[model samples]
Target: MKKKGIFVISLDLELIWGVFDKVDYKEKSSYFKNTREVIPEILDLFSEYNIECTWATVGMLFNSTWEEWKSNFPENFPEYQNEGLSAYAYGESIMSPETEFYCFAKEIIEKINATPSQEIGTHTYSHYYCLEPGQDLQSFEVDLKKSIEMARAMNIELKSLVFPRNQFNSEYLKVCKKLGIENVRSNPTDWFWQDTQKDSLKDKIFRTGDAYLGPINKSYSISSLKAEKDKPLAQKASRLLRPYSNNKILNKLKIDRIKSEMTYAARNEEIYHLWWHPHNFGSNPQENLKDLQVLLEHYKRCHKEFGFQSLNMDGVNKQFQNILRN
Candidate 1:
């Protein structure tokens, strides 16, 4: 008997909530507009290829109106050291009907909830940043409560999570476990890939180079998945299906590197997890979707050749539990 390789894709589904701090929403309005437009296409492609996925959606996206969003705001909201990082302030100060493209996505969330082989996971109530300064377990619990409440309003019971900004801490994980999240998408097992607070120039350079070259390992063993003895299943992400860029040579190398790693995981029956934000597809969506098609095609060939299986984050946890039981 052969152990089966598992493939999982988790999308950080945030509209304006994810990137409001990074760019001017007015200037990049078209980028977000394009993001909203292409989501159905992305889902259609996933369905066509029979891919199962997890959507770690921001809790704010569950709101149908500004009033509902206000009503559900967590009482113990984050007070980031940088006051500007607060999504609450951003929501109050800048939000308007015209800006709804970035602020709201209840329709998209409903579509994902109804889709087969898809799980709705939480990305916190306000795209909460855990590793950032002035954040703690108490505030996080309130955020989690609001997140759960918002999902409950939509008739969704979220169990899987991917921290906003990939921030993770032991106390944070404890909070997640307490709040009913059974599994989470953790960063790669690499030592250099620590939480956001420790990020530096050297780390950024290595991550960029690793995208093109094949030095660092991304595939993980079945035993590695069992490291969390009694905690939320830490399903480590293997690679990011990076968005397309202008440099043709660099882009080709990146995609090739991903395919090579995927092949290794399939051959060895390890896990390969790929992730990215939906807004990444916003700019130059045509090329981004095209690159996605190439990966899906490769996945098809891998399934035929090596018996690789597709799973969402929830499915990954369930699969690992069954593996441990046997």
Candidate 2:
């Protein structure tokens, strides 16, 4: 039973907290509103397919109002060398009724909590950047503690974490383990996926091309994870489910590449983990949902033919633990 193929899906639910450093709120306000509107629909699709997903939400998003958000800030804030990278600084003048949809999402979090087989994981208290400069282990721990505290306030115990921006730092796993995180979404082993914070134009080009051309075998055998004794198992990501594209031919190729990879994992009895941000669907929710439905349908076929199973990060971690115990 353990040899069967495993399928894992994770979502980084950051609202604007994830992109505040990069995008302007006023210009992308409608985009954020669309994202809030589409989350329920996405959850409904997951239910229809009996899919289990891990939503690694930013802790700041749990607040219903601006005042609540301000009160929940960590005692010790991360002091990044570049001040623009600080969410706390950005939040100073950003909260209002106009930006309410982008800043707070407590109601959306409740909807996800109500969904069956869905795991609510933390994306850190402030979407903290682990690999960024001027941030230390002590500060990271403070952020994680704040995240756990906020989730607990909502009756949620976060067992899984997905670092913001795929900044996969092995050093931080110890902090996560100490704070009760069972697993974390690590970056893929391929060179193109490594050191994402310092990503180069060449690497970016290759990553995008790999999505359509199949430059590498993204899936891996579960036995590999068994070899590691790390407490917070590093559940490596296989691919990012790139958002809807207007170019029809390119979109088809991207979908084909994903199908081919899933087929490989299913046939070889390996693990295939796919992830993306919920806001990636904001611009074109219908098209994104259509593509997602196609992928889920492929997953059903793979499950029927090869015993492929859909599990969240928590489920995958539990399965790995069982193997170790046996």
Say which candidate scores most in lDDT: 2
lDDT of 1: 0.85
How do the residues 249-282 of candidate 1 rate in per-residue lDDT, one tens digit apiece?
Answer: 9989988888888888999898899999888998
- Against the true structure, what is each candidate's TM-score? 0.96, 0.97
- In model 2, the Cα lDDT at residue 215 comes to 56
lDDT of each: 0.85, 0.90
Candidate 2: regions farther than 4 A off: 226-230
For residue 171, give model 1's deviation from the true position in Å. 1.3
Model 2: per-residue Cα lDDT at residue 77: 92
